[model samples]
Target: MLDLQWFFLLLVHQLIQFSSFSMGMRYLRRRTKILLMGRFLYLFLLVIMMSFSTSGQSKSAIANFQKAKEAFKQNDTDKGWVHLEKAIKKGGNTYYQPLIFAGDRRFKEGDILQAIEYYDRALQIQELSSIHLKKSIVYKYAGEFDLAIDSYQLYMKNARMSKERFRASELALENLKFTKRKYEEYMALGAPLEVVKLVFSDEKMEYFPSPTGDDRKLLFTARMVQDGAPTDENLFVAERSGAGWESRSKPVLGRVNTRLNEGASSISADGEYMVFTACNRPDGVGSCDLYYSYFDPVKGWGFPELLPGNINTKRWESQPTLGPDGTTLYFVRGSHSQADDLDIMVAYKDDEGIWSRVEKLPSEVNSSGRERSPFIHFDGTTLYFVSERSPSIGGSDFFMARRLSDSTWSEPENLGFPLNSFGDEFSLVVNAAGTHGYLSSNRGKDIVPEQDAMAEMDLYEFALPEKMKPEQRLFKDFVVVHSATRIPLGLANVKLKGLDEKEVYTGTSSKNTGLVRAMHDGSTALRVSAYKKGYLPYSAIVSKVELADNSTLYELPLTPLKSADSFVLRNLLFDTDKSELLAASEQELRLLKKLLLDNPSLNATIIGHTDNQGGRSYNQKLSEDRATAVLQWLIDSGIESGRLKAQGEGMDKPVATNDTEEGRALNRRTEVRLR
Candidate 1:
């Protein structure tokens, strides 16, 4: 009866919007944007307890709805949402205003049952297909998974929205069904994982846990806040499994933690570099940006520095996870709006140790819904992250994907129940050994319905299921050092080529420790190499047979180039017993060319040798032709012919015995002799 036409217009104006990500009470995620862990959740819980959210019909109903309009006008969504729920209860639903507003407000506020009821009430008034989409989400939250699946299917079938309009939600529905099937398939094998919550001896709120590659330290966000005080978030480190760990006394990260919030960090393999997210700082480029720090034995972590300008933009960027090599970064960037807008991005460190431009991951991995919390395992292939693109399980469920040999990703496998149940689950990290995993959970709230939401979150550890273990493989520690002095060559380049002779990994030795750790499937043939300027490069072959018993520590010696020195070019590849080179040899060939070009006065010989697999005369002619090809290449590249010569030793001078493929691989060689 009262003029309520304005309210209907307001409702019609907002037909499409939703959110994702389980709210994490821990630091960096605590107050992050819509796609990340929820900081608003802490405030939302308090509001839910204090506000009116039941249905009723009173004379003050009209006045209550008016207050909601004013709150929305002020852009105070949380305030407006609280008042709107009250307005709905006070007979405001009879006024022809969209009741879907109250449903979404309750859903995001973690009130699952009431949200469903609100949606049911909305459907009673008008049957919009979009209302089914909203019901599916609330049903999933309430663990009415069958109902959720049905609602999603109905919305997709009944909604008359055009293909251009319905494409996102349509694709999301497909992925949801597929991923949920995979989750169920894995869970059918009987529950093998036992998630054990760790009661921190210090007992502050600790989450975003990442253990060092050596398992010596645990890095996470830790905070302590009283009921009525301002919240402060800081990074904390706890010594693991020793006096520092047993005492359970955690220390604030010196120099790295500031008065403002800092959390969501990733540490390099050698513990020398840490990249994290910081927001609203004086020097920030956006509302939030990625920052980094270097760890020095004498100084702890250095004061944080802004990453490359291009990596941080005017939009939200956070949750950086460093790959095992520490050169590739998998992180998230998004607007502070819908979960559908959040996307995972990546960047690689170049030969000069600079981060290249950021690129979003392909659509095969990311969905229109929120994607965050990326964790790349030590194997360099298995990637774990959180996504709500599939709402069949938890709205934001943890998933594992593999980086294929082609550099694209395999379909995501939802880490099954026990790991991903109802409600919000995120921040799951596996140990370097792939034997165990760790995550954060509020146990009191999980087991007891009335448990206080203010309770600090505790970390949990579980034995990883065998099926969920990272690829069974081996890791090799490569220490790059000078041949003449044995001094560590920090920041040297390291590379590994697969059996197909394509590069499997290209990264640097640690900037401080000069250590480059590599991992691979035990069966693959590989070429290992390391390079530094002012030195002869190091290269070797790890045949599949040799790889079976490969040693853990490979001390690669980088010989300083000088007069009358001969070094085998072990990285060069040839087609079987043929003489012509394979494309795989280009990397070493380019390095050789660069070295010769750098030293104009140094004359060099292109020497070639072959294994004893062919006739002596035939081998001799083949070697000569191969060496001549290299010499011609050098001359054509503007090198002085007078400074170079080609020669053939054939099988006369072999580096190793000419038996077995491993020895034969070593016997066939190209060498550079400084004459």
Candidate 2:
């Protein structure tokens, strides 16, 4: 230190002595210029001498710095740190280089306190604007949030007005605030989260669970290794036991698991079918495409076939999630060239039992960043998925939205805090009862002790927070049958319309089983209908209380299309105490129009009946007017006016006792009689 100081003092001394030579020759201009050149030469000599003295003092620092570099190259981080500290102590404090390097190394190693100390020491030596960002990050890691925020403010303030560093400084501060808000909000609402590790699935790293509507089983993705070869992703199943899953010896599910990759499956709510992803198959239209398989009564699961329609392209499609009723499917859709631009897509099954063309969800849910692992809850309204968009918890995080209508969805809400962290959390699903949620994460070691310490990805179930829960759901099953013969009918198109919101769900009864299942919220009243070829359409308005019994099976009994056959139109709606048809009757009216179009030679009489609430004469006229409305609609829909006749029963014949509201609702009906 003294030698360096002596070097600087010597330079000042030579400068002063050379100025005297220049002053004495000032009277003669040429002599003065010569003396000035001599004075410059003397100053250069002094600078060269100082350089030698400083270099001699810095030799030990340079040697230690080289040692630190070699240690770091060899990956001996601890040894590198030791050498770095020694170098700084040996007069290496001439610049902020070594100090900042040490700070970054410690920060990357997760040594928060040491990183903070090094950054603080470096900032004192030279107040570099970039050092403030390093300091801010270390403070954030230490949970000193207030200090971290202050550091970010200083960093941004010291940054240049127009430069690359300023943008990073600005974004860093914004992200810090967003992360703090998300974390604090989670803490404020957070409770005791009990995450259950499904060790039953721990054998080969099972993930992306898709629970059946009854929560009776969990279908997940795993690996299938060939003879001494690399593994291919495949589907597996785990049956639900008393309170947990049954640890099976080998639960490889179905013929879907082939030598090629097939994974990320979704089971229908009725457990009658599944949709999964397969890649590079002979028939595939993309790198990965969604495949469909049906449940067989004799065999466990039938062979998988490529999903019908334009659902696949040159892009990749994976991670399918079927809606509870099995009518709609949601999945991940990504481009072959841009992986980060993945979006969540959907498709609906039509009356013909083929999936419609795939449509990506709107930008409201699919942000500019990647969207993945969509899981539609059994409630049939809420959708949970993963997004790497803004306000994320570093990596990907779980976000949820609800179906506002068939075409629109609500704003996405982050599942928040302990449920999401610094790493990726994906493929989140809620149980049938909405009591628990399941997901896949590599955070098993930190979240639970019993889980394997090095578990890369493990299945876990956590009780869903109250705000995070979807609506309580129940399974609604039914069969379409003949009214007189009581014989089951297949290929019936059944639709359930929620009375509260007019939200409709559609499904086709199985061709062989004659079984139909739809998800119900257990609260909203429903207008359920069934239609089939060569049969009269059947519809009934079911009250909310009737929808409570999950085990109850309802029936849609259709009368065969023949001369003189009549069936009740229970879903027909009219204005109170009037005959004008309400807008609510449009759906039922469309079905009647289709019926007339299908049978051109058929002639029918539209008869309106009333409950036992009004006078006979008044009821007769009102009923007659209501019946005429249907006839007029048929005529307007291109049915010949002479082919339809209107009549009124006027409460003369009661179908039920009418003592209770249910029986009265049954008695009030508009019926179509084939003539």
Candidate 3:
């Protein structure tokens, strides 16, 4: 017969073995029979010992239950739980409070499976069916959808439920059914889906991963814990390396990250600017406000600045994502009174660089339920967000909407199941190429042993489903710089023009990084032009065939427009000996006209050059005719003739040796000199 001490030691050994099984050691399944035998022997010995200790009357089960409550109050959870289990075995169906209390405690502690077992034991002992509803909720969270639905239906049929409980059960049933259907559909489609946990994820909750357009850097939020209690959520960064992501992440934006919570951040496509949400800060205008910070190579991150009143209202505003244009921001705004009714709102920077009044998305995008975590793809047309609106699997599910017009959005479409499970899914961001997507989820195999399996959220990346993906377009990333110093030029105006010379798109390089990006539909040939103050303008043509390169990185060098600064006009063409410009030269002439118009106080001299083949006098006249033709075109195009002059070098000054064909071709050129 086992003594009490031996029984306790055996119980500890059994618990150790069970912990290995809980930790997902499949080989431990063979030890299950051994554990069951040990438990049986423990109960047998306890019964024998109890019989010996009691002479005529046994301890009242209610008394044992009271003792268990006292033990729990004193913080002895193990002893309390063991005593409560004994009371249930002794009292059987005579009492229900002990069983219910144990179940509630387990559920509160996040032991959903153990809570369900306790609830099931209570149901078997008595006809109290109301506990089924509690079991159903626990089952649902544990991903046991089929069992949850059955339990919910049983509770509704066998017990009197409150109106609120009835409504919740109805909603849950509908969601479960929808989730089942979606899972079936996903299986039918056979789409190739893969989800990978980021290497840097840890036991603590890590979520809201925002990667730069290059995918070389990642920023996320981690819930920091101290003394086993959550303290604050702070932004963390991980840089990609050849061996994978860095082994660990560190807090960034020193001054920007205060003791207060700072998370749900969005980095600009160029990785130069960041916008994040902070709550209850001394400078905040609302309960939660969006803040902005910019990166500088020399100074690091600037101090976080509260957004303008137009974007940050006295109400709550958070989760800001900048459009690829870097001027439009989409964020979540909640009413001061009804905090749960979050709506996705957008604001655009005006010509003065001030954000406009926040506008809630249309009803088609924002439903009566909450909508949050708006991520606009780099393509600029597709919008992905999280919503609790019906047709969702259960909780908040991922949905996408496309821009139909400037102010209109298409009906939101569900991202479909597996991508969006019964669990809440949010903070999804797609890469520039739109092929890969990242989000925070708690539905996969656990990587951190200390974390609850599939309960603590971690960042995950998956192949973007084809049905939900946006139209793939070629993107061009531009880095504009000064020619002499190689320093990035701020406020450089960049424009994309179609073959017909219609301006398709326009944006400015970042003030700090001098980077800009533009996307094309892959159908048209495009010409890109960049211009900065007091610098010569630059333009390049990308043919449709070159769009297959996926991305084209261009470093545009702009020379300062100082006195006597000259450059060859590569866009101009003429008949062999005639001075009339070709149609291809029309675009360049228009650009020059704009330049002259923009700088009215400035003047330019148009000079033409010729190769050595022609006679000196004849070549000089030919050059003169070319220069005169260009001046006339500029004048006709609205440039004041007084601001421009014409001259001919006529082989007198050659930039390249004129002996070879290539050098001769270069020598025969038109030049522009600012004076």
Candidate 4:
């Protein structure tokens, strides 16, 4: 119809020019000819003014329209739509191109009815074959289902005579069909489709979500371009408000973000201290070390310091997760022994904020396969972790274990089906309420089809099964340490003995510190042994009497034997001044039996000494005979002969004045050692 209008307007232009020429010749009177010619000129000027006025509006609208397009490209969609609206109001239809784009932007932004009004305005001025197809899109998105079908039918009718037109119309019809299907899907879901706005997005990398107790402050990881070059991922934070997250998503700079990668941060429940992982730092012992930044009320995050040698060794230690109570710390460390992957380990903090010895999680929780990202719930007994070792559908899956009434951990249960898939899930944290949790995954359940592969992770909330939500025992301190060093020990031999030193529950500390956690709600007596090279074994009887809510810090000390420490030989007997083996020394050899049994590592040379009163040669032979007699006694007592060396330091070596009987007694002696 608009084409017919343009054709008629062209004919009117020719008539106007012809009429002016005819009128000018016929009129002889100058005033009359001038008046007739003036009327034709007036008409022509009016037409030119209309044409130029339309073109001016076209230029203005096109300029604003271009700005709107630029705004959309900048991801400022809201501002883009505002400018596009202004372009339409300024009569962009004065130029056909502005009219088409204005309608397109409006339709794509989901303003279907507004788009149809603009498209209708365009069609009224020009009947380009393209306008009919846009009409179909407007009707489809506007939920005018029957109108959409009718518009598409008309498009088919118009296209039947032209193959090119038919193909274009068919494509539009197919798009309308897909839109109708999506519209049904959008309506069927009972809840309103809340738009998942990209609060923070980058083409680089992102992970870790450490939110405070109030959920107002969120700390996460983001890898963004720095200094015109791609850089390692670092911690970035944003705050939440009623209007949604604030912009820029600034990095947590200075100490926390170094030249190396740093992430997996955990804030204390009180929000006072934050522990995170910084790999390959200058002071690190291995590939990664757990460093802590204290949150002072006056100053913010302080300088990060590497944890002490008791925990971090020449091995990788990372993923430090502080329990909500802020005392029990959980982390993952690669196995030092022959193991395939890393395991979850834990450490305990003291009143002075010093960490306990690091120990691995129990075998029930940590298997031979890789287990990482351990998060203890607010309840403390419920430990949630990501594991690829378990029978997951694929990759890694979230599994949880509940504490039992007997204090043992219940068999782990997989968080099944829809919550987990064949992709990797990590950085899991359950809320203080224990009902909701968050994790990161690449699965796209809500994204558009074309961008599904690029779908980024967002926070998800899930419920705990009622059976898995048991009350947990609060741990004030599980202080297990070495007896000698007065230090918290790792990998010590701990057994629950039945009042009589019988073995019961036994395991080593986790990798975080030497403090291994086991359910002790019902145990009677705890027997612990701290073992190390060159130290006497020490055992303690921790009476589980008058049990209190908070446990006490028990320390054990071990004593070691030196080479000068001597033993008595009761079985060695001889005639006056004679050196020979006698049955009497057998009783004294039993004492050596006890020492060997107590200290399995003790190997020594049994040397016999003599007083200065005897001749040197005779004393040497007599001393040798005495040493041989004692060695034979030790052998008879079942001591390994290979462990005993016999040597006589005759009259040459005397300890005291030797003039006194007590000094001579001391001078004639035997010694043993850890050889």
Candidate 5:
């Protein structure tokens, strides 16, 4: 006999050759023979058609798989899925490669069922370590802890080549056992899985909606590590609405997001400015430096400038809190003299409008131990911060302190209870409403999947007990600043006035931003006047603030007061006998006319005053006429009547003593108040 293999091949070749020959012979005959041959030829053609069609379908299926791979690699996940579906429909058995890649892309993008479907297809083809790992991650995200653990174990069995991979496998194994135990305990404690979401995921560590108390904006820090390589931590902000946070979380770009690490940002109440820390740079005072920037509603962020030398030094200055008033800056200062210890420092603006050198907060607030993350409440009286120095249930507990009557700080009080655990808590912010806020912690249950053995930091919002509502109150910020010199001014009295010019509140600037934010309740447009001994008082009005107001920055550009200037009283009290002044008084109102003409949009009210000598009714009438005379002069001087108002106080209201003649002369005056 011929060799067995050669004999089998020879048989296959003879079958095909005979089939072809018989097909040719059938086509050649005529009449009955031709008809039979035509039938045979038709059968032969049918076989070829079937074979070619099957081969074309297989090729198309393979092409689709290749296309899916290309699409996935290019990060076009949606298109990749479409191509993958096409490949699956072609009824071919060679689509495992593309399916596996698609599964990975979907898993990374947070898609679960679709990823499992593709992963299942890949497993059907062959057992792959990478595919098992992918399945494990999906299982974790799906909350199937047990299955995810098994998948991870299987992956480890085959992928023990690299030390890093081995370490990762071991860690996963340990975490799986730990998680199983914790799950049992949680169930035993009557806790639900939904509540467990308060924990963080190891894969994504940054917690949003920072505890900063302002709901209009959210501040958070995210470490931008790529492929396990160190990258600068970045600070990001998101605008919050009742509808929820908007898309495109805005990054505090530019100097705030420097090549060096810059994160842990806090925005003042009005959201006009922010301060954050940057570290490991040549410009840094110690290992880190605190820098600040202001946000203009119109022009955007001013360049990041270093804090005054008084606040920054050879020591590390970081974790800055731009107080609600923008006047006081509270921060953690790590002293070079103390080496590793950190103390909280407070700085304020002095009377000359300069920041005082950093002064250590009273011992009640700082200690030899580290105290950081000082958040001044919007009310401008309460301060919340993290301190390891205080007694606590954890490594670091949050504390609150009240600004005492004498301007010293109260003894710090721990925030207490379920809000504190054996784990450390950091990064807290509360909204003006006070019922809700956020804090970062790792003390809760593990959130990482069995496949991820890494520890995670979680963000949680806990409500204070009902009886503690008063203690849980929150504050907002209100900053008053100069239109020029972004620096904050000290000792500048900021008087917050209501629409009626009644004093509502008062405050002074802090060291960080030349601003003073005060506290008030109710709805009213506010007029803020910043006054110095000699400099012209700066006045501005803030109107139409929605409810739950905080730091509202009102910038004032002051004009200096002078001695030589004398203002004319066009609409003075009436002539010698009459209580009314005549229209001819317009001549004396020339200066007033020019002033109103120069500022067409300017609005002012002319108040007429008279000496105490005339009859009460007659003086009232005379003062009224004098005021009307000024108003008429303004209208004639091209000032819009809509922009002018005349009011007569008569002799009833006198600025100086009305008894003495000199005092009477001063009392008989006309004054203009601009709105």
Candidate 6:
């Protein structure tokens, strides 16, 4: 059988060489018949030889082969390989099936060298082109670029390869060469920044580090491996202390974590909401689907629910990342059966909180090659992701795109060498400040001796170079709560209108924590408003001088609506000492009208007050006129006259002492008393 295999290989090689030469038609025809006859005779003898050799082989070798198959089926990978090795030693080398199976198992187990050895032995017995391709892929991942290129070239040279296969091999070879050049360039530049390994990392695979906007808490995925095989992947959370992360981690979202695999999570800016990937669930629409859960202060994590059908299809979907505003979700969607092609897609939540249909990013962001691990910054305009598109350093490199005003994305820019190396770099998350960044990488220098070095995927934090950093903007991260009770006011609408009177941004407070985060372009002259159904509307002008901190925490207080509750209307403005209302006060007036329309039974009195500068009788008439003017405007705008009243207090009821200009400015105000 061994001789027959060798003879067949030699005959095919000679035929390939013969076909390469120019010959007459008559000579070609005669040679083709002779080759066909030779092939037929070879197969006839090969089958007879195999039939006879089955009985001649020792019983122990066959038993070992059978045991190897059973061990592999029973999930005993190490024991299976041991038995296969013994079987190969006992005259099993004549059979290529066992050798190929062992090689495939070793490759999947991260034993690249052992897998290559087995593949080489199988190649000696038969000319299998796929084995060469598999060896090339393993070599490429192992950082053996030169050997990988050589093997790929060998695969391309085989006569039996299809044109499509040849083209793929050529492209892979070109990418490998490009990667080699990038690696050399990186070495020349030296290390760009310091990368600190977190203390939570262990011998098991730990990756996908997602830190809260403040960088005080971290969430990562860890594979639970037993006997050198992964049982499931689950999420672990750790807190930061001083400059170092806590050494220990605990499982979070216990209700969400089932026996099925769950990993690749992205937490909201306030750490209240999470969207992650879960696979093999009985209710999943695909092989993997995205799920969401919210953190409750009392009940802990709420039950996880699969995302809507618009975002998840029969095709695989995973790696969800929520945008800074908490309404946009960026995730990966691809066909699991075709593992090589993935695209970055985004879905946005409408005002009613229903997620829009998923849309794939343009070719500028998602190329024909794979693109994954999208990380939209808290700034909302800058996006960081991984892509294998052209101009990449290697396999999958980090790239970034900025959102333009027209809602289209800018051309992606490759985050240059060192930060993006020959191996895949993904799961990137940047802090709100944009000074530091975290990502998962298996660079050559990051190998730990105690772990399976070939499969070492570790979390790393590095100081972001200025060129690679996202645009730094001030993010007002605040929680809205009731002023009297201090209870969180969830689902409050937050809006930021710029000086141009354009509604620049709008978002809602988180349901779990009442947290609302908005990114500004450092233009502080804007109005920020928070409103909910049952609470009084709140609005404040953020002056230019107030945008200082990278992350400013503000406690937005909203007073609950009740009978006889009165407060100053901060936004309503009138001309100095006149009854005419300013145009800037239009927004506040409309909101008050809406409040009245929303609650038909509610009634309010519009009261006007003044400082002590004016004469008592004149001030009384002026305040009365102003109060009547406001009441008439509301009546003209369709509020029922029976539900409104107008009154004035001329320097009689001053909330602030009229001792100075600031005090006097506060005293000249409009107040609303609900009844």
- Best of the candidates, TM-score: 2
Q: Rate the local accuracy (lDDT) of all candidates.
A: 0.72, 0.77, 0.77, 0.61, 0.61, 0.76
TM-score, every prediction: 0.67, 0.73, 0.70, 0.40, 0.47, 0.67
In the range 540-596, model 5's lDDT, one tens digit per residue, is: 446546314544444544344343332324223356756444443322354355445
Summed over model 2, clashes come to 0
A best-first ranking of the candidates according to their TM-score comes to: 2, 3, 6, 1, 5, 4
| lDDT string, candidate 4, 159-209, tens digits | 535678667556556645644554555466555323232355445445667
TM-score result, candidate 6: 0.67
All candidates: CA RMSD (Å): 15.2, 6.4, 15.4, 19.6, 23.6, 7.8
Better of 3 and 5 by TM-score: 3
Q: Who is ahead in lDDT, 3 or 5? A: 3
Model 6, residue 308: displacement in angstroms?
Answer: 7.6
lDDT of 5: 0.61
* TM-score, model 1 to reference: 0.67
Q: Write down the RMSD of candidate 5 (Cα, Å).
A: 23.6
Residue pairs with backbone overlap in model 6: none
Task: Report residue 441 deviation for candidate 2 (angstroms).
Answer: 3.3
Clashes in predicted model 3: 0
Worst 10 contiguous positions by lDDT, candidate 2: 446-455
- Output the better candidate (2/4) by TM-score: 2
